[model samples]
Target: MSNLKGLAHLRMSLDDIKSATNDFADNRILGRGGFGVVYAGQLPTTHRSACEPGTPVAVKRLNVNSHQGDKEFLKEILMLDSCKHKNLVYLIGFVSEDTERILVYKKEDNGSLDKHLGSTDLTWEQRLRICLGAARGLEYLHSSVGTEHRVLHCDLKSSNVLLDANFEAKISDFGLSKIGPKNMPHTFLATVPCGTLGYVDPEYAISGVLTKESDVYSFGVVLFEVLCGRLATVVKSKDEYEFLSRLVKKYYAEGKLDDIIFPGLVEQMKPGSRELFSNIAFRCLNQDRKLRPTMRTVVKELESALEHQLINLDDDEEIIGLSGSIGVYNGHELVTSLCFTTNKRKYGPFNPEADNRFSGSWDAGLFDGFYGRHGSYIDAVGCCLKAAARPKAQS
Candidate 1:
């Protein structure tokens, strides 16, 4: 508990937690998993240590009957406290009473990415943003943003990814995370490999050796799921399920890559960018763990594809290149999603969890803009603004 000293402000007494959750009422439950039940809680602003009244929170109470014990619960708290990133979920506080343990977090109004598989309207651009955000989060964990040591998310799966009030992705559930040697490039063996079935790296399964690459492997699977709108593992029949990766590889080898892409996404696909993404994903799926690119590499590759998207815009729309086409978006929509400007007009945090928030048609004008001639979005926007002001300068 000494490690928790710095985060004492986040500690909550059992009574306080109980009050916030209304005695753990069943209707307040948000979701349940093998380890616990997550309930939506409201922290009253009146309490000295509480968030504002009506501040939505997620309260995860350990299942008394479950095998997960106190150690795992505390591990998650410590891990969350140590990491901070826009793509990572924010922890609010925790409670530990006699024979009971609980953790708290800001309620990500949007649910997990896995829930949107059947969405008929999810766009490729939106999916790419979610995947890129998750990659950056994983990269932060592996590189230790400001520290010398690294952290292994041990569990990286679509289910562990929670969407914020906006559709921005946040990596969650660090109960199984492990810290690695400082500034080292070696694999650490785990007594048991930890992660979801389809997303687990094969090498970790065989050797019990865990490394940052294991997280990359899981992320690769997630990348495919985003592109395909299919679960990592799909039900083949009543009795069995198949790995989406295997099916995708089979189709890719046969040169029928279109067979694996999610329905609506095919029309949005650009040849060069699509191939680049597919190639990167394939590299990530390599059985030889050493063969997989680092998350940094993954980020750059994805960003490059996005940039290429800007370069390949429709002929008539060439002047206004998309910023995040791997370019940062030039329009208000992209600017809004990429920045801290929340939808103040909307009541409560925008809930994208129950429904796919990216489903609505993007404003054509919203995405219309010129980046001029720069490699990055910031530079392009600057260049275009200057061109627009050239006449004034002449006057």
Candidate 2:
């Protein structure tokens, strides 16, 4: 094993974590998951640490009853330490004492994408940025960077996509993440199929063969969810439920996709951008794994769609500001911004493990509020300005 001391991540003590979280108060609880519970915490020193005590951090404590073993726990910590990217969530520190294990991460004030799905506050451009951020994170995982093997995020879902104060999306929850073999020409790895119910890849579920393509399939579902402003699976009636992909394909086949597109989003979407996104979503959802595009291709298509969305905006000072902010001119190529707009007060701390019916499943008249919501166009422009000011390029 690599020397743990050489790693850049902090090896935290349990006593320090206890002090930060006030002995794990209920009020400090941020969310819960199958593996463990997450609490809102603060480190004592911001000067020497990634965050100050005033700046909140999230502490995930593994449950004593959890099925995860020491091996899986070490894998998660090492994966977070080894992988570094702007779009991917990073570990601040960890604590392992006796049977207690904990991990710390930078707190995202806006919470997960699932919490904001049906809200109209998120604009099309903001949604595009979120998608672009996630795509880039997945690309980094699939890309051979910093390691001989590639990592696969087995559990890719809206709930796993976290938004910072700027609403910049970062892929989180690496408990189910896996790493592919190094220097092998193999296209897929065989492992037990495990993922969320709605987002699991159909092929992996049947054959138990894991691959980067599995993540691609789940991402396609998320794409449609973002487009339609609904969950991946919707309840049709008491005994019937419909998957969003099947519903979208049916609409697309009948030449009436607009019928299903989120109401306000249709007005904000540029024709070219919408077409490109739809095409990519379709290709990503291909049943034949061999036919799916690689993560690199997915990132290119998403960036292309973003370019169209930006190009369609009215040419004003705001537009120029937006363009300048997200587009960084490094040498010759421009790496655009992937920031977003969010309302901090809209969503309070949520129990990620607790299933809220209103947010989890669809109800009759669920589409009512989703259609009439409106937001300012300047959010994108403002975000672009922020992006342009950063001196260093991000992965």
Candidate 3:
């Protein structure tokens, strides 16, 4: 524990930790896992620590009887203390006195990404941003964290990706992480493979040979989880579990990815953005480890995907009305023409037609956008409206 001694500034007494967590009250607990329970608390700033005084924090108290012992605890402390990035969880301090093993981290207001999966609240753009942030964090760990060695996050899952108030991702949990030689194309370590079931790399698990690509494989599962809006593993029955990685590969190969895409997300996703994002995600899951892209490439692709999504957001324009033509074609009613009316001028009458026309005009309220179904042609149409802004009183 000599290395721990050098982190004295980050060491908090057991008494302080207990005080912050109200003596491990049930209500203070934020979450629980194989390691232990995490508590929400506000530690006094009196101690010389990384966080502000009285800042809200999450204090993870390790289970004494759990598999994670002093060794794992020490590894977590050392890993977090050395690696610092905006997209990585910030370690505030720790308590390693007597039988207790606790680590404190800056609290993330939005919690883990897993909690929001399959929910409509998270927009397509927000999910892309979250993925990009996590990728950057992983890239930092894999490339630049250490002078002689790069870190490999053996466990990369949605639960480990925490989200701040702004929905920025912060990769957490480093007890199972390993370090490898820097600048090596593939540094192999013969060790027992360990990671979350579905997220674990099959090659490493079967051969007990670990490499940087193992982390990439796990990250690939995470990318698909975000895109599909589900966990990597799902309970199929009492004795069986389904892995999302396999399903994604099958779906991608068959070009049936639309069947598994999160319900509302497809509507928000641009075709090009979805294509780019899914292509990268599919490439990540390739069976050949050599084919998996480096974390740097993953970051660039995510950036491009985000840029593609942002191309026609029309953030500057305030839409006020919509006019379009609907006609019956081949026994199906379809929208044939559409135009957006903004504060400045009309945008378009795409696929214009004069017959079977419908128009909606609003002056005070804002036009959110149009929503409808589409096949070979637009099948139906509806618009989203927002209440007008309340006028301010004169001073």
> What is the C-alpha lDDT profile of model 1 across 352-376, one tens digit per residue?
1222122222222322222222212
Q: What is each predicted model's overall lDDT from 0 to 1?
A: 0.72, 0.73, 0.84
* Tens-digit lDDT string for candidate 3 (345-370): 77555433658889997563545555
lDDT of the structure predicted as candidate 3 = 0.84
Worst 10 residues of 3 by lDDT: 368-377
Q: Which candidate wins on lDDT?
A: 3
lDDT sort, best first = 3, 2, 1
**Candidate 3 similarity to native, TM-score:** 0.79
Location of the lowest summed lDDT over 10 successive residues in candidate 1: 339-348
Q: Candidate 1 at residue 151, lDDT?
A: 82
Name model 3 segments beyond 4 Å from true.
313-395
Angstrom error of the Cα, residue 366, model 1: value is 24
- Taking the tens digit of each residue's C-alpha lDDT, what string does model 2 give over 1-395? 23455544477878888878999999999889888899988886532466555567789999978866566677778888778888888688887778888888888889989888888999998898889888888988887554578888998999899998878889998888888864653357888888987788899999999988999999999988888999998777998878987888788889898899888999999898899888898888888888988877887787667666654322222211111122223453332322211221111111111221222222222111100101111122211223344567778
TM-score of each: 0.79, 0.76, 0.79
